[model samples]
Target: MKFDPNSNLVYSTDTGRISPSQVEKVIPEGDGIIRIHKESKGRKGKGVSVIKGLALDEKNLKTLAQKLKKQCGCGGTVKDFNIEIQTDNRELLKSLLEKLNYTVKLAGG
Candidate 1:
């Protein structure tokens, strides 16, 4: 038989029980401050507002992203615990987030 490095024995008689590898969800931690910034590096000069430092679960983050997008009348998405709104209006986003009682700050130049 050929050796397969990618395959692992799930169980063996001598070992009795073998557990498979577990995948863990990564949660982002912040300093209780929400930051909004503009980025246009890879999107062919199309700017996007990136909101970070939100200490919420994935579901809540999505919900918040939806609300913000709706209120801003724009499109956005939640990725890696950050919200990416397809707009360059950081001030509007900052005000909206502040109205929701989140400590907001404008980051980057």
Candidate 2:
């Protein structure tokens, strides 16, 4: 078989698809403060504590979310780099975050 330098390899029987090079994940930069707020806007009056401004990546965020949920004894999730806990205990969240050396502030009403 003659090797062509200008030829591009699209696929091969050994490999199902030729994927592009992996791109680095870009984490959003945050200020030196984390905000904990209560949001019940679209949740039909069931408020959830939203924690934002953490400078951690997705995996770390999820880990932190799990820890927070365990500590709060409630369910939560990490969405868009923000932690949403199914509880209105923003004070508990603030204290927990502060214990971890994060500057947390209660935002919103």
Candidate 3:
């Protein structure tokens, strides 16, 4: 039999095997600060720009993500209180956030 690596995931021994969790939501404090960074790991050397530390709730955050994605002309999403644009768009994102009145900071060198 072919061993399936993903066939054995358990939430708990008593609870038996379970699927992954997707409803995990992060609520960010509205501190009016934002951070942008570039990440390439686990993406086949393709760098993605991540914008985090935004002070917005889920609804507004999603709206903002859509706007940024549209402006960047790329796909993106809001996850774990962070906004991830599919490509390295740090400079553009920073300008956008600044225009939105967010105190933007570039993260990492």
The TM-scores of all predictions, comma-separated, are: 0.79, 0.77, 0.72
Assess the local accuracy of residue 107 in candidate 3 as a C-alpha lDDT between 0 and 100. 88
lDDT tens string, model 1, 12-41?
687764656543467878999999989999
Reference-based lDDT, each prediction = 0.90, 0.89, 0.82
Give the poorly placed runs of model 2, Cα more than 4 Å off: 1-25
Model 3, 36-58: lDDT tens digits are: 88988898998889888877788
Question: Which pairs clash (backbone N, Cα, C closer than 3 Å) in model 2?
Answer: none
> After superposition, which runs of candidate 1 have C-alpha atoms over 4 Å from their true positions?
1-21
Model 2 TM-score on a 0 to 1 scale: 0.77
Task: Give candidate 1's error at residue 3 in angstroms.
Answer: 16
lDDT of 2 by residue, 1-109 (tens): 8987985556668776564553355777888899998999999899999998999999899999999999999999989888999999899999999999999888997
User: Comparing candidate 2 with candidate 3, which one achieves the higher lDDT?
Assistant: 2
Measured by lDDT, the strongest candidate is 1
